[model samples]
Target: MATYEEVKDIPNQLDKYLVDVRNKSELKETGTLPASINIPLPDLEKALNLPDEEFKASYGRVKPSTEAVVIFSCKAGGRAARAANLAKTMGFANAKAYPGSWTEWAQKEGK
Candidate 1:
């Protein structure tokens, strides 16, 4: 799993989707890190398969290539790591799981 220190310096590029896999209620209870897109782990495959225009229409932006940086996060490291592994199995070469997930982010952001 990627550490907060590792992912913190990653570029906030438009094509990269910082995914928050925690459910909607969790999202509502605690706001996500800046730039993250809420596509719970269960929906990840479908979301990634969308065509450029459709994706932009649905997700509000286009995603990078399967080989590009795609960051995943959850309440802690476990879920995000599993999500990242799933991404890789789905052909996303650069998918990374943030070990310092919501808890770490919340602590750092003072949420």
Candidate 2:
């Protein structure tokens, strides 16, 4: 899991996820970090079941190496935490949660 302070380092890290586990409206309105992807909490399981190309089509990228680290974020981290846990359960090797999430991110970004 990641703290607000730790989240600051994500941009500099390789293969880190900046997922927004928010709903579509939230995503459409506010988006996520620069390189982050959208994988709403509700769609996570089906997403995990998709083929790599479908994953790419859905989220704009193919699956990362199982060893690659990824982070999930949301309004206040609840959905992010759940999503991260689900990702790990679905066989992702290093899924983690950004506890501060978008609430903290927007605060940091002055949005």
Give per-model TM-scores. Answer: 0.87, 0.86
Model 2: ten consecutive residues of lowest lDDT: 10-19
Over 4 Å off, model 2? none
lDDT of model number 1: 0.81
| TM-score, candidate number 2 | 0.86
lDDT scores of the candidates, listed in order: 0.81, 0.80
Per-model RMSD to reference: 1.8, 1.8
lDDT by residue for model 1 (23-91), tens: 888899988777777888888788888888877787666765887788899998788898899889989
- Across 6-109, the per-residue lDDT of candidate 2 in tens digits comes to 56777777567667778888877876676777877888889778888988887887666667787888998899889989888888878899888888888888
